[model samples]
Target: MGKRKRNERIGALIKILSHQPNTVFTLNYFSEAFEAAKSSISEDIVIAKKMLEELHLGTIETIAGAAGGVKYVPLVTPERAGFFLEKVCKKLEDPQRIMPGGFIYMTDIISSPSMVETMGEILASQFLNQEIDYVITMETKGIPIALMTAKALNVPLVIVRKNSKVTEGSTVSINYLSGSSNRIQTMSLSRRALKEGAKVLIVDDFMKAGGTAKGMMDLINEFKGEVQGIGVLIATREPEDKVVEHYTPLLYLEEVDVKNRRIIIAPNPKITTKI
Candidate 1:
């Protein structure tokens, strides 16, 4: 590869490393892909690490022993996360996003893959050590984020359905009020989906009245599973009593000025200590 092309490859690799910390790669892996020597790749890695640390993005950790490799660890400082969310909140600016019931409609944010992945990564970073066995979400919309979080944590996912399935031999069912509507709804789980004492994290696309969230908690309790934590993509902040006390939200929409096409969202509130 020419000098310019080699430098570009190095830069692209650095960007990939930024997101995948703790992932190790062999020198042969890069050497074969870039047609570069191990010595040159090592130098590139050193320079990239310096650039990353100087920019305060993350740290490049290098292991030098027999199984040595490189890894990037992103320490999303408080300022960084807050700033990122602030910009993300601006994307929700739509006059039609405001519902008649004084709620900010944020289905768009939940449906966007980039937004959902970012929210999942941020939440997963916070629970790096809670020994999360699997991620749990109520069926439908929450599936994407729940699946993303599960992938980030390298765990399985279990979706609670509103109805039973004929394919599953037996099922566990629990009743809880749906968040959108105050009426009670049944959530079902397959008999083999989760095991007792498994630490499960509950995540949803949005949090309004939180009835669905509470119902999820009840279903989890029924399965003999432990609720590790709860999280949501967007939350309505006017009435603090609307959602559970011990939960995390990626964005807090305090107000939605439909007439002005303005929607305000603040940084997600982090849980000081897991519940």
Candidate 2:
């Protein structure tokens, strides 16, 4: 291949780094790929890093030592997070979303690719420094955001099933009280899903009383994994206290009045103010 121009090199560098967030690409590797000198690649990295940081897209980091390389860390600025979350709150406030049982329908929001990808980036940013080994979530609803979080962190995603699957081989099951329904529920995980002492972040679609989040925590404990953090798309304000404490919720669902066809929700003050 012929020598690549500066702008061309920088563009390609950003594309590769951002595509695999948190994955390190060696300078030598770029040098070989672009048919450029290590010095030229290093300069390209500096330019890419500056542009990304200035635009609040993400950050490119250089690692030192033999194992070190350049990596991209996808981060959402607090301002950006607050703005996006506020928009979601507005969408959720539509009274039409209220269900018969006083629940707000949010399947479309959580399942949206663009929305969840942004949500995942925000959640992943909060725990980026924690060196998370995996992102965990319950089956079905939470999978999309959790998978995106895992993708942003460049880590694996562990899904806890409502029941053990024979295909998963031996399993570890746990029973916990459901905070929302006030009933005992069972959740199981594949024995080989997580390694002992792994650090994990729990991502969920919603938290009413945190019953499901707590259940996931208990399931994590079964494997001796540490719960570094918990993130949920929305949490109920009435609960005040939850089965699991110390969680980050992007939005607070204050009320869902079925009879009046009213829904009240807002971005978490903690998130907006912190930004």
Candidate 3:
């Protein structure tokens, strides 16, 4: 191929870095791809990083040494995160989302590819410096966001299942009380799923009393793993004291008044205050 133009090289560099967030790509690799010198590739990286930072999209970071390379970090700025979260709060506040038992129906929101992708980016940003080895979440509802978080962090996702499946091979199961229903429930994980002493970040869709989150923590402990952080999409305001104390929730569900047919929710102040 002929020598690529500077604009072409930068555009392609940004595209490649953005698509594989947190994964290092050596400057020499780009040098060969663009048929340019390492110095030219380094310059392209600088331009791409500046553009991303200026636009609040994300940033490109260059690592030094033999193992070092340029990688993209999907760090969401407080302003952009606040705006996106507030939009989600409005969507969730619709009375039509209220269910029979005062639960909010948010299938559409969490299932949206774009919304969940951004949510994942925001959640991943919270623990960017934690050096997370895996992203863990309970199966089913939380899988989408958890998977996306794992993608943003460029780590593997470990799912704790509600029940043991025959296909899971040898499994470790534990019983824990459900915070919402106040019933004893069983959660399981494959013995081989997690590595001993691995640092993990837990991501979930919702938290009422953090029973599920606590259960996950216990399971991680069984594998001798460390819990770096916990992130949830929404948490109830009434249960001020949750089973898991140190958790970051994107939105607070203040009330779901079934009789009044009103839902009051907003972005977490901790998140909005930073903006």
Give TM per candidate: 0.73, 0.96, 0.98
Q: Could you tell me the TM-score of candidate 2?
A: 0.96
Residues 169-207 of candidate 3: C-alpha lDDT, one tens digit per residue: 999999998999999999999998998999999999999
Q: What lDDT does each candidate get?
A: 0.75, 0.89, 0.92
Question: Per-residue CA lDDT of candidate 1, range 163-212, in tens?
Answer: 99988768899888765677878889888888987899998877878888
* Model 2 weakest lDDT span, ten residues long: 266-275
Q: What value does the lDDT take at residue 90 in candidate 1?
A: 71
lDDT: worst 10-residue window of model 3: 266-275
Question: Candidate 2 residues 1-275, lDDT tens each?
Answer: 46789999998888888899999989988899889999999888888889888998989989999999999999888878889998998898888888777878889998999999999998888888897999999989999999999999999999999898989999999998988789988999988899999999999988888889888888888888999999988888877877788999888888887877888888877666653
Once superposed on the true structure, which residue ranges of model 1 sit more than 4 Å away at CA? 1-75, 256-263, 269-275
Error of 3 at 49 (Å): 0.8
Full-model lDDT, candidate 3: 0.92
User: Alpha carbon lDDT of residue 77, candidate 3?
Assistant: 87
The number of the candidate with the highest lDDT is 3
> What global local distance difference test value does model 2 have?
0.89
The residue pairs that clash in candidate 2, if any, are none
| Clashes per candidate (backbone, < 3 Å) | 0, 0, 0
Candidate 2 Cα errors over 4 Å, as ranges = none
- Clash total of candidate 3: 0
